[model samples]
Target: MVDPDRVLVPTLGRPREDEALAYALETFPDADVTLLAVVTPLDAPLSEGGVLERSEERTARARASATDLLESVADPTATERIRVETADGRPGTVIPQYASTEGVDHVVMYGHGTDTSGFVRRILGRGIAATVVERTDEPVTVLE
Candidate 1:
């Protein structure tokens, strides 16, 4: 069987992402997997010891958490196949851009259910999963 060149998993501080990634690895054992944790910075600059500062710290923490989470799931020798990339942009935009440039054949994103509406949906417009699918030539797999 042909293994995918890469699988991109977009994370947003979700704990379940680790489990989903594990499933994807098991399903495609030979494929390289990348766990992406996007750090979308706030519009305003963070004040000293303020909410924005805390949020930034949280973003860093999330990335660390993701690395730890992924490490727990896979063997150390095979861990080289797993990568973690962080970017300061929208998930929808970053994911597709990475997929196009990285020669990714499949993108495995966590599905947050089919509830689209409000500013979140309007701003994201069907979100990272749909955006990646529409923008990239590769196939996208939404893991619930």
Candidate 2:
């Protein structure tokens, strides 16, 4: 496959596969690698203040996770081409939407399991990677 201009890799606070990030950084040194984390709104009935606080907390954690993953890889050479971002929405929706609208030439995602919970996997069904493939026309590469 041709080298992508921009690549998107979606992650949660918990990563199912750590190598996805490393692979992108290694394989596409010239491409902009965006580590995107999705913060899905909680459905719990809480006061406005409580909801806002919770949202802020989730977003912070999401950014931290992306930063941690990049640090874990310890590749300082690719730092300039990498960016971590947090988006507000369901992973299944936001991941695909971002890839389509953000001029992403490729998407790299972990296949099968997601996060650290079997419960979440069941709720999300086939997985976020599968969702992206089904929803986006961009080339998707799934890493097991």
lDDT per residue (tens digit) for residues 2-35 in model 1: 6687887777665467767877788878888888
Report the C-alpha lDDT of model 2 over 1-113, residue by residue, as the tens digit.
Answer: 78999999888654454688878877888899999977766752111123556777878877897888888873787777889998987777888899988999998878746
**In candidate 2, which residue ranges exceed 4 Å CA deviation?**
44-53, 112-124
lDDT values for all models: 0.70, 0.77
Candidate 1: RMSD over Cα atoms? 4.3
* Residue 5 miss distance in model 2 (angstroms): 0.8
TM-scores of all models? 0.75, 0.82
lDDT leader: 2
| Model 1 lDDT, residue 83, Cα | 88
Candidate 2 to truth, TM = 0.82
Q: Candidate 1: minimum summed lDDT over ten consecutive residues — where?
A: 43-52
